[model samples]
Target: MNQNVQQAAAPGLGIEVSSKVPMHWYNLNADFPEPMPPALDPATDEPVRPADLEPLFAKSLIAQEFSSERYIEIPQPVREVYSLWRPSPLRRAVRLERALGTGARIYYKYEGVSPCGSHKPNSSVPQAYFNKIEGIERLTTETGAGQWGASLAFACALFGMGSETWQVRSSYEQKPYRRLQMGVYGSQCHPSPSELTESGRRLRGQFPDTTGSLGMAISEAVEVAAKDPRTHYALGSVLNHVMIHQSVIGLELLDQLEEAGEEQADVVFACAGGGSNAAGMMFPLLGQNLRGGSTTRLVAVEPAACPSMTEGEYRYDFGDVAGMTPKLMMYTLGADFVPPAIHAGGLRYHGMSPMVSHAVHLGLIDPIAVDQERSFEAGVAFARTEGIIPAPESTHAIAGALDHVTSGAARPGEVVVIGVSGSGVLDLAAYDGRF
Candidate 1:
């Protein structure tokens, strides 16, 4: 048994916590038939060595990046912090199923219970812990919808560290409260494409009046981290370590399904952004499926406005717009592409996670793109039925499940699980237009 795992239900919030949050996070690398591609340094055109990233990331994180372990033990300090909101409830969306008039049973893993209101903190707490123990004083990173920024900020405050975040410009303007929330958690926040870094300056030169994307924001944040010896970059998604840290979501879901008396989900869904949330929820399922057990269908829902999985090319591409990070083989819509300022700010990234892209390439899961209107409609219907307002990023999942029921593809009594990634309480402005 994992030492930090809770066998008994963690009590709070008047909700049933059916499973323990695992002390060891799962890593799929050991099980993969082929190792993930090694990122190459643009300047040297060589496979990026651990020492090459020493200046930009904690050595511990760098080791985890290349590790092929099936499970990495979560530091006790990190697990202590996770006790605040681990084992988030897996709810059967009975009301939603009835509202949709579907015979398929719908379940959701609600991540909004966390203080940062998303699964971002699942990685943030551990990332902050790694940096703190490594003698790093401050962390720098980028955000799209501010969930990642706010999560890291809260974790840093708990660890008595500091963080600087460059949030996407559109989200900065649309979600002012997220910036204020970061400040409350003792982190400084700035709009991306700010004239603070050379990467930001170069982007400004090209698109002086354009909304910023995650790729652009990552470039700005990486520039700052690479320059300061005391500051290291902490990415929100699309990295191996980040995705591994997020396995807690699926680890809990594994037990939840057993408690719910379901054999396996017929289909599991999550909105794909940089792909952390979907990967987090689906990775364990894939592991089970790969082992010749559980034939659960995995699905990724992406925004049509920035459909990296559905319309992008499968090739080696830079993770950022400025070509600072290593080249990853993933589905990309061109790193330089500036996505339209859609309401689902988090889904505006140009490329998918390499692991997720590889999974799609192998035909392990299916990807579908949903437009703004249908996502919002599904979100509204879910709110009315389930009494929980989902984040715009999560609405894509709702829309995906809704599509199957309406199309008469979902059979009666089939089980469907959706990842309700976060709450939209801070995004009332986006909902105001509807009212």
Candidate 2:
């Protein structure tokens, strides 16, 4: 089908299926997993604990709700912007099923159709809406893979607001297409530690060839946002509000599953960076769990190079792009530890989302970290079978899905849903190397 025709058919008429079982759901609770035991900071050798997260958690955008008529009404402007790419589709992987030759059914909710080509816009649009309503003039943020930067830029454009982005140095250098994409959306992109802020300057002095980390980029963005009263920082992932905004994915998936005549998924999988996309996909599933569905396995996949959930310590750490910002209690690898340059740049973070980390710690969810080569292998397999090239970061989830299927863990007639958070069109170079 043509793009326009497909877009037109997305919401109501594209497919009509029914749910196998009647299931009721509930709203997400504000309460989350308790903090793990504190770890000592390597730099200062001080105890890092959940108590240190008080200030950062207090500032989370998700912690608050919009109180405007437009927020409640969903204005035309907002609808117009969303209609451009809202309501992404949930697709079943028939070809993948043939390839696996397993009795299991595979499905994926595609979020690559967004202007930013990822699920980031789910939050970006709402974030822009609230900020514009609050009379904010500009937005600032850090970008590791450029998906978040592009999403913010697109959202700001919808609101006629300017945006500034500090891209991680490795991503800025390695993914020119991503940087260009951000620029195309009218956001200025600078490599972090570019003498832009005090943090960057100090870091540059320490290591002249430093490739900026998310921690550093966050520091620069926070500096800009805090210094300018008119500007607000927009984060692509983590935080409750961002995850809540992304619930549209799961919400839509529920409707799509009904259309396909499927019931509860046997397993759900999504890539975990800062955890917005994963949480978006799984939270609704968790809601299903709350309603007493049989244990639906929820899996979070991360990069082994930056395995915050699997290998890192849960402790209080700064959430900035640099180590300069206020601390948040989270599972972190270490702010100063630079991860190896991996194709999944977005997954190279040193920390996990507080909510996601909390969930994992409480044993409410499970996490696994995969190496780059294996992830790329899964990406290739998915592209060949499903005819969709997934982002390197998201390929981790695909990798996990493949492992689950190949292990014969899922029986025939069981279902699996993978969140293909973004397309890998901009990542052709990475694929070229793998193929």
Candidate 3:
């Protein structure tokens, strides 16, 4: 190693490298012990065929949604774009461990370095690419907390395609900067429950004064895309393809851990909303565990206010309020349930990802929920020690890790990994009364 490399490799500072980006995305379905329940067509109460998804998604994404391939090659164009921010650093949280006074070794994969300051871009770029290649002129989608909207807008801008988003009313009001970010990326943004679509108008009439939900926003976006042949919908999470695209995170982390000389992680913690972040960061490791190559415990942390995995029932439910999308089999707290307006807006969804739900059902994933106050407390502590303010959604994982340590559940010297899905730079308002 060079002089600077030798210094960086010194014990206790955590390892950071930039050359370990994965060339392929690992598909968890290939390693799943059983076939996940297929998405159901609401009209027929039968399995949804790829043809049924034709109006919303590009052909390439639809193929990936149904694919059983173990590893999908990342396209050269997509990889070229990813090179700008791929291989995000995995840092040992020495300061955080010291603050907690715990012997357990904590590490975090920091994904805030991306252009959108979140992991959403991992999938958004590819989603845009696939749509552009298929001659789609514009993409429409929903957002909660605006990360996904900004990400898709950024990706669309890169591909020279137009984009539009319907953001949940709560986040649109709370995070105005996110909408500005989207606009800067050359996309149009609207608040959910606007009068533009029938779904939005109906929702507005039904709940006039209420804070909107991700489900509601999804209904509006889906309605718009279904009506326009030149436009396609790009979902940020809760599907097979999104999770597969996110696998780059876990794939890169695994390589980084080996390079940093860690044998294996005892547990991996990641905040789960629609489940893309957790799935992207844990699926590769979980696949190894399923195949008997590793024994890492995969933990999906969620907001207690909308604890789908922890408190919901596993059943077929609509992914959106208006039921415009297919009924997916997963852990759900009713399609229309509106969670309390918490700072972690990104995690206020009513259902979990089907793959994550299946993994939880089979006991492959341990799901946990953290309340708002405790999560914010953990985020503050981590920021004070590590010098990076975590996104409200990412705080759930920090809280989960702290819970494991403070509760004496983590063994001394055990290796723990957390996925810091994003930065809270633009979310400073969320911390106004939080601290």
Candidate 4:
């Protein structure tokens, strides 16, 4: 490796951005005991071909989807964009530790400092750049809590491209500022179940009074992209390429923990919304557990209202409610399941990521479901102590971490890391009613 690459990949250099981010993104597909099941053709029930996916994704990303290669190099352009928040701060939550009256050391990787106020930009920028190079003029995507929509909006603006997003109905209503944030970044945002796409129309007909889910929004987004030759679909989570882009979170986090003079974390917590950020934060640590035999525990926390991990069936299911996309093998609570209203609208998806589901099947992550009240309690506690209000989705992780800490899953003096994935600045409405 070159001196620059070595320094960038070195452990204990967490305080500053690596002069250069690591060249390659890690892919777990090649390392799994058996290959992850392929996305199947909805019509033929056969594995989808690369060309079949070309209609929706950039050619380069389609290659990354099923790649068995251990590492795929991050494009220089993407790395340059990531430089803006490449090394997000990892702080020891000393006050929260004292407040909990626990002897366990608490540390959190704060991704809220990013321009988009979340880890979504870590992938969105790259997706936009790849599409920009591929001559795509417009991108369509779905979002739940507006984080992904805002992130993609910012990315498209930076790349001089047009962006369209269909946000879940519940989130759109609960977080109007998030939709406005997308508009601020020069993107059009619509509530899912709007009269824009066939899937949305069908959903309105089927359940006139129901709030939309991510699956429904995804179908709407995909419908528009499939019809427009110049538009390619972008997904914020649940896809392999997105996970690859998000690995930057875990990579920097490992270095940060090492630099903090904490050699290991006994347990790590991240909220699982289609499992993007959590998988991103835990993938590298999972490798250590599998290959290097590390003892750290990985946890995936989800809202009880949409507990795809803890209660869903592990089976082949469509990513969208309309079943427009290829069928993936993952933990799913049925595409037709309409989750109850919850503040963490982002976690109201019907299925988890196929890769993450495989890990859970292989016993890599412990999935837990928490209620809104418990998550809010934790979020309030975290905000009061840490001075940064966490998004409702992130509070699931806080609840999970505290559950582990109090239940004695993590012993005294043991290190614990929680993935504080986003800032809830745009979600103050969800907090106001509670407080």
Query: Worst 10-residue stretch by lDDT in candidate 3?
Result: 8-17
Q: Show the colliding residue pairs in model 3.
A: none
Question: Tens digit of lDDT per residue, candidate 2, span 343-400?
Answer: 7888877888766777787777799998989999999999999888999988999999
Q: Candidate 4, which ten residues in sequence have the lowest lDDT sum? A: 8-17
Residue-wise C-alpha lDDT for candidate 4, range 121-221, written one tens digit per residue = 98898899888888999999999999999999988877778899999888899899999999988899999978988889989999999788888999999
By the lDDT metric, which is better: model 2 or model 4? 4
Q: Candidate 4's error at 317, in angstroms?
A: 0.7
Model 4 Cα displacement at 380 (Å)? Answer: 0.7
Off by over 4 Å in 2: 1-27, 30-79, 321-324
Mind giving the per-residue lDDT tens digits that candidate 1 earns over 68-136?
998999876777778788888999999888778889999999999999998899999888888888888
* Best model number under lDDT: 3
lDDT of 3 at 13: 31
Relative to the true structure, how large is the alpha-carbon lDDT of every model?
0.88, 0.76, 0.92, 0.87
What does candidate 4 score on TM?
A: 0.94
Q: lDDT at 112 for candidate 3? A: 97
Measured with C-alpha atoms, the lDDT of residue 256 in candidate 3 is 87
